[model samples]
Target: MPSYFSLLFKQDFSDLKAAGNSWEKLSRKMHDAFDTHRTKVTGPLHANWEGDDAKNALRFLEDIETRVQIVQTEAMAITKVIDTTRHRMEQAQKDLRAVVNDAEAQHFRIDDDGNVRLPKQWEEPQPDESDETRHERQTKEALLQDYQVAINRAVDEALRASGEGQKALAELDGEILDHKNKQMAAESARDADKVMDQLGLKGPKVPDDPKAAAEWWKGLDADQQREYATLYPGRIGAADGLPSDVRDDANRLSMEQELNALQRGDAYAVPGNDDRLHNLQTLKAELDKRDGAPESKQLYLLNHDAGGDGKAVIAMGNPDTADNVAVQVPGTSTTMDSTGGQLTRIGKLQDAAENADSSASTSTVYWLGYDAPEAPLMEAANTDVAGPGRAEDGAQPLRDFTHGLRASHEGERANLTVMGHSYGSTTVGAAASGGEGLDADNIAVVGSPGMTVDRAGQLNTDNVYFGQAPDDGIGWAQGLSLGRGPTHPDWGGTRFETDTSGHSGYWDDGSQSLANQGRIIAGQQPEEYVPPGQHNG
Candidate 1:
């Protein structure tokens, strides 16, 4: 009898044992591996065949193909890393959600030594409840009266920031508006001056203080005396015999001339010319304003780090609500921009998350800054993704992220949630595996190639959420092909890869996959609709 396990690599030993064991025993092992992330078999061998037998050639070729798949995924991961930044600037309802978002998520644990453990339980998010329901639960757990005191402090800061920003903008607006109005007045003054000069009444036209100026201008210096005398000769010449009509005309013209002169600013030029120039300036200013230069919109930026590869942004339009948050981490080819890119993707991802749930909060954040490599990520599905990024370069980055989550204050997660897409999810898993250091409640993983660890429980956070949008191509990239070599062996991610939408579908245009994302961004939990499609057709 041919033994089914007789012809494979040592790593395949568990598979052989399973083949020989009863279905129930094998199922138990599988369950343990699924929930606990502990497994006997990691994968088939990638080493060079020792034997010259031609039969080995078939398997060797298969392994090469697998490696190629891993490499091909590099392009997708690379794009994700570079564009996650430059997201919108909003204020997080930090105070409200802090109590729970940090600690309740269970991204951390307390070891006997009293140190925070990074990962003790994975974020096993159940897709059954809507974001609103999850938010209610999170809020109930986080927002106690005592926690409100602490939250008040954070809220004060946000309010202060918002207030100051508003004040600055208001002042600036006033200044700009005042300038514009002043320019308009100047232009009108110039026009009045022109009319006065045309009438040959170059004296004060419209005095700022009409009554006083009328009394004062009644008298004049040599030039004014001569000019006014000419304009109203009979009235002034015969001091006692002043004509009422001429006096009235002179008074009106004098006031108009005064106004025109003031508008011109320079008395040297005829009042008309000054008015024309002022008007031109006003016109030019209005035109400029009508174009793109109307007003410059300012941006707000925030980042927090826990010494290691943990990098993230704390921003929200409304975190107190059931908002959505996306924490993206890169595998290889990452840099500061990688952090930014993850955020930018979150912004683009808005459409996807919104599609998941129209009524959920849509606020989101991009969390980057892991110890992942700067470049040279895997290129194909068959390649070893864990070796370069997770096992080697990205280890610390992953640690810091999870640790930060654990450090999140517990019992005040009024509205704190997270979505880890692709390599970013792997990063989340790594943080959870640390045994202590994250405090997030709900976590979502989409298009993840691999998270390396054996179990989601090790990833820490309370609710472990996963999204694979059938269209996400990461399945082939993350999973292995049996004929190609081995099966796609994630610690517990096979369940997410239920469709063929490919790597990008997790956030495709208006895809319901991320509808709950908006909810999470608003500090709300994602809706639990496993087999997650409300409209996936």
Candidate 2:
């Protein structure tokens, strides 16, 4: 425990902060050095050199790289612990000074050791003393107790902060540098979380309103932002209003942690854990393939869940900076395992949109954030797809996500579009009709069963559009008491032509359906569909 006297007068946090900065600089330098080594030494050796000697040399270089990375990670952990302690101690010092100043202002004397003393008073009441004088003395004594309590509380807070800081510093053992690559990263994150818990700096309770959530994130200092993102990646990653890059970083860390845990066989108790593991691996592979790709092609992972049927939200480009943004919600049977294919589809959509208008940038997202109904072909009749319950439950989340996009976007507002396929159309419809709606400029549904609404006007958006292949069987679900699906002419929305066949072929490259979707996403009107009998030469 720290002494009250030291906390009140002698403690200085500048040196600690400086040390933290030094560690941070060292970590950055180490990272740069490692990158240089890989590019200049190992990369050439692996590409040009051969034989056992070359392999041995490469192995040695790889070990060196691993060791350097571990050192860098450990350095970051040290910086976090030091910076957190400095912040906490500085706050405690500020509190102590505040209470002491208030005590002095009120004519109460505070000693060097934090003891409060009343201003000079008569040792005893004299026989000639007036009643008012005695009462005044009594009042001063009572006030002295209050000042004392305040001083004691401030000192206790300082002591607690100091003790926790000490514990956190003690846990950053140098031996952590001896661990393997993945182990080092996971352990470092785990240790940071412990420090955060000890210092009472757990991740914030994010607000439901996307605007409020964005403001809340902006209010945190840089150190606190980094701590929260590193120590509680899962929570920060999933928070809607955070910046896309920040969310991407946090989610990547979370995915790495999940993969490490699953590899260690720690998730065996979870049902379908193997499937979860496979899905995560597939996602990682897909992301890795995009490394060093163009900025427009880079994938930003907004969120993910490996449990149950699994879920994920991925963006093909940075939505915050794009001129146009579209969120495409998948229908039934969508899960983490299907995320790779979904990413491919969104990429194609992005390309199509960009091709429509070369002057403006576009970002397309695969929003599998909701738990859509999943069932085998044999059990399709018993799935949640037959009911409006899942769509109703998912509507609020979908709305929140879109609002978050609105809150976090930079510069001019984006031309936002929300699209859904199959049952996902039901979710989009439900979201667009309820609450404040999906905050979208256009709502499009392909092969939609129903939108959980009777008309496009009910969706609160005038730019509603629908596309359904003639042979698609999913249209039968509209008769199952969902809503008046957009396929009907009386639905009061534009119907786009679909040149492809089957329920899933709408996204085939260069098809009329895909082209029309691209046009809608680019904020342009698609060519309206005319019934075969209605069209005349």
Candidate 3:
């Protein structure tokens, strides 16, 4: 039998942790010194010095600054790795000891040598030993087995991480040496703005197809990717085929730049800037509100813009790192001004999904990236805003967004659920019915107007889900001008029950609809979710 955490409570973890802390402290000191030199020494030289001598001195100073900053960055990264390894090791040791102690309390013997032995008394029970005693022993044994499995996995992970961290630390000196000696000259001469283009990394071929897009994205190295995103954020931010996290970062930087330009240009005061300024202010307010909210600390701004009525996609958690991701597509009349309410709706779904599976994490994104119809109360509402015009325009973008999520995802594959509500459902359906499909695992619609497809199977997804409030008047428009409602008996999709809160009430707090949505997103068994009409009984 292998030893259980034989290295537990060892001095190596502490030694590594101390070394990491010292390195980080030293790195910080070096960085601070470089900053002082740049401001005090280099600043005066650049202003007062003359000709070639001054130019050479300034270049040397810049090189030293870059080198110091690189070292600081690497040191911080190494420190993080060491800290992670130490934490894992500490937790593993604790878990192993707890398992052994618990087993000992249950009348089992676990020696200091890391041997878990069955009690001698239980090896051959007396004839008088009660059936209850046997049952208790059996339960205890099963519990011990579970604990053993957990600790083994934990120990393995900790050891692997420690080894990798040590290797990385060992290689850092060589890496720094190469950067200074071999790459310094080229890096110094390289134009920051034209680096991507010079390296043949500029103007990436963004394919319309999602799979092709993923391939294009995967081909770029870290440096190339960073440069492309930084230099041409506007194009990359709106590009459909890029990864979600990458797009998110680029979009955020772009948004800030756009806001600054708008402020500088006095956009609100300009003749034709009313729409753009209004959109920008609304988006800014929504972002501020979300940022200020305590519950939204983990939220990430995936995308945002001030173009045309404005577009935004905000995730309550990192979609790239989550085990499950739900994209909520809002319907007609949804704009940048309405984003907060949409965010709230999707944020509730985020919590619900995480709460349903306490062991896992979920991401919910409020997708206002499309130009939704501007439905008004006038008689032309049905033919204008409620028509298929906007939905058709948005179908391709919606498909690309889902595909981008899949391309950028890390770790295990996540369950991707695309949900459409009202006219938004029509948009989802249009995309799903297209030849390329929406690239989602599950397709769900709530209070759908129509999906444009005749049947659920046309969605090209593994599972199709539908929910509708009994009194939802939106369902009445099914088959008239929109697509067929998924809940229709002929639609052949699974129906989930929702409350009587009418249209847009499916996501209401404490509602059955919300619970079922959570269950579906978590990849739980269908039988676990309560279907429609089950709440009354």
Best by lDDT: 2
lDDT of 2: 0.79
Task: Write the residue-wise lDDT of candidate 2 on 364-452 in tens digits.
Answer: 99998788888621245855877788889989989989999999999999999999998899899999999999989999889888888
List TM-score per model, in order.
0.34, 0.81, 0.60
Candidate 1: tens digits of C-alpha lDDT, residues 1-537: 322111110112244233323332332333233212101111212122245663366344433322222222221111111111101011223333443355446444422222233333222434787788677546544434334444445445444544443332232111212322332322332442343343233443423232333344444553344334323332232121122222322332232233333444655334355444443333222221222210111001223322233333422222223344344444444433344345446665554555555665444545444445433333643233434344333445444333333222123333345556555565665565554434556566666655555555565665665666555455664533111101233344223323326555555444455555554544445554444435544
Lowest summed lDDT across 10 adjacent residues in model 2 is found at: 174-183
- Distance from true position, residue 284, model 2, in Å? 1.7
Give the better candidate number (1 or 3) by lDDT: 3
Off by over 4 Å in 1: 1-300, 304-325, 336-341, 348-363, 374-385, 388-411, 469-473, 476-500, 519-537
**Best TM-score goes to which candidate?**
2
How displaced is residue 150 in candidate 3, in Å?
A: 71
What is the per-residue lDDT of model 3 for residues 452-520, given as tens digits with 9 covering 90 to 100? 887999999879888888788776677766666676669878877676487878888888888888877
lDDT for each candidate structure: 0.38, 0.79, 0.68
Per-candidate clashes, comma-separated: 117, 0, 4
